[model samples]
Target: MPPAYPRSPRRNGVHYANAAMTVLLGLGSNLGDRCDNMEKAIEALAGLPGTSLLRWSTVYESNALLAPDSPPMWDKPFLNAAVELSTSLKPLDLLAATQAIEKRLGRVEGERWAPRTIDVDLLAYDDETITTPELVVPHVGVRERAFVLAPLAEIVPSRRLPGTSETVLQLKRRIDDSLPAWMGVVNVTPDSFSDGGRWLKDDKPTTAQLELLDGNYIDIGGESTRPGAVDVDSETEWRRVAPVLEYLDQHFSGRLLRPKISIDTRSPTTAARAIEAGVSIVNDVSGFANRAMIEILAGSRCDLVLMHNLSVPADPSNVLPHDCDPLAVLRSWFGEHLEILERAGIARERVIIDPGIGFGKSAIQSLEIIDRARELMEFDCRVLFGHSRKSYLESMTKVPPSERDPETVAVSANLARRGVEILRVHALDLHRRFWRVYQRTA
Candidate 1:
């Protein structure tokens, strides 16, 4: 009997928790029963093994950062607070748990920066600074959001924002009303909200159009992302984008026009063909989760743009809200894709990240991502914003697809201020004008 299992020892029925690690989290609510949502969040946090709730700062109320264009359904007040926790769990595990709690608390999805029932943000994880795809230990927004800064200062006066070489108090001193740039819109799709398919059937694209680009972007996609659009096959997409690439190669030959040309597709065959045809970038809207697509891009001499997309069905009626924060979700999704890319031999530098402005996100969330585009700079790769004329802009301006140029230009200017090097817009002339204005202002 296997030596009687070494004679089972008598049990005292005693259990001990693991050594606790210190963590700081920012908690806020603007939905039903704000106080209750926060309290529940605290309880959920405490329920995690190897964690102990230390203290929470007093809750403060604030207005939504970017209010939605639609009329308010109710007087939704925002509540903000901070929590200190002692946990034996590793930083990533703790963060995963925090996200789970947020989803559990009826935090319905909306646009970026939209109000919510509860928002739990990891403020800091010990004194360490981490820069992994999964976790940026010192949260990216630590120094920017006054709501987060005020409560954090109240609790941890001596604490410093990691990687900044500044104390919490010092960071607070620099806080202001400004927001950071997020992602630029690159529409490989034909009928995208902003530019549409002006470059689709090219006839020497006018200088005012794609011809004037500084050869700085990764040529994006061929599908149409306009609402109620039909999806095209790999062959159709290849045909749609091939001429544009061939033209670029012919016109800007030997000039290093743009460092790379990106093929935006979900099909492995398309990616492979694009690569064979001299495309230098692979902007996969499906997030490179497809094994075949990953294999095609693996070890290739092309850069990749990994955009976020929900596998779930999307509803057009639910516009993006002003308080929806997808940073954590994006972080998790990127971490998964990064591993896939790495296994496929893609260099880290060749990778770019897009939050997928309107793929499956609400309008408010899109705006929030745009407003906080700089937060993604923490990833240390070139950021691409593809929000040219997305539904969010349409929702806000009430402009039909053909008439959204002015709004798109305004958004582009805002993105430029956030240090976005690549702005993928629809109209080449509009982009050219925007660049001229940007250069002058800079």
Candidate 2:
């Protein structure tokens, strides 16, 4: 089980003063032009009286519902989506409206999970928990269905279930691994190799960049760990990172969109401060070698990323020995460190191991690790590959950092196929969409 964080008052979709409630609706169609059906459904939803469509999720293709006793022809794939709306209409009334839309869209009275032209379910109405013969607020199917959870998680990840402690994103993480967790990168420095100084203005994280890269798990780094990058003291590092943390805390904490935070720092002091600031993950590029850092991690519930780096700031000249097998070296390093972490009382499940793509590897070594990533999964812990626009790609194509997303996507596709759990990348949207399509198509 993941460690628990303190909860704030649950956010409601309903605006009591105006008697309007925020509502979540699930949309699906396995019949007709599915995409067209979804768009028409959205139009009908927005056209409903006293209701304005707020936002909708991407149309995800999922296998149609089926059972042993069901007809074989019902196996058509579904284009599914979730939508948010605000309305003064009561729950039953809104449900009735959705049903009307389904009826008009060619849905006929049918058996449970039967193929249909469209299906619109009343997922949640604000924080209202309602159960009746006709409806249940936070539809019971929401918890277990990936088809529903994927789209809902896209738009409203931080919103808690009407009566449960779990948020949409939390539930998705618990049950679904069809997609990898996307960790957006925020490098708060002027000297990082890629996209450095783009997100920073006056030595602080700009709101524009933070908003642009908003995601469930965001990795914030003060000191760049890129090869030959200059180092800063703990205070200086924290100074660069604290603003992003503060910005997130002030603007997002305890809200419907609060993101789980990660601090990418090697300094134990910086990691400790980040934990105090409510970060859930400490991505120590130095692999928690410091007894002080291990001690700090031992006492906290924050997840640890034990990355294998040859040296901090990445000594390019210090590449792995040519004769030694890179995977063997990684296995040895991970075994030793994981044992150290286990001795210190951190759970194996809470640790994510990174082979440190370009940190200390030659281009061939990096390619070897990428191709053989599945071998690293032997340790019974999640594996992370931070191969976002690094120099290793230059061995294939000599593009600058800004033009490396396609290469990043290609590598990410390979990692995803190998069952890597998390991908730390510069291009979050591109990778996310690519993977979504990949999963749907495959």
On lDDT, the leading prediction is 2
Each candidate's clash count: 38, 4
Reference-based lDDT, residue 137, model 2: 81
Per-model TM values vs. the true structure: 0.52, 0.66
Poorest 10 consecutive residues of model 1 by lDDT? 1-10
Question: What tens digits encode model 2's per-residue C-alpha lDDT throughout 1-442?
Answer: 1122332211233221223789998988999888778878777776677776665654555677688788888878887878888888988889888999999999999888689999988889999999899888889878888778767765666678877897675666566444456688889888788888977777766657554344447888999877778889999899888887888777753342234678999899998889888788899998987889999988897778899989998888999998789999999999999999999898776788899998889988999999999899777666788999988889788889878999999999888766676788988888767865786577
**Any idea what lDDT model 1 has?**
0.64
Which pairs of residues clash in candidate 2, taking residues 3 or more apart in a chain or in different chains? 13-22, 13-126, 14-21, 14-22
Off by over 4 Å in 2: 1-4, 7-111, 114-177, 211-214, 256-258
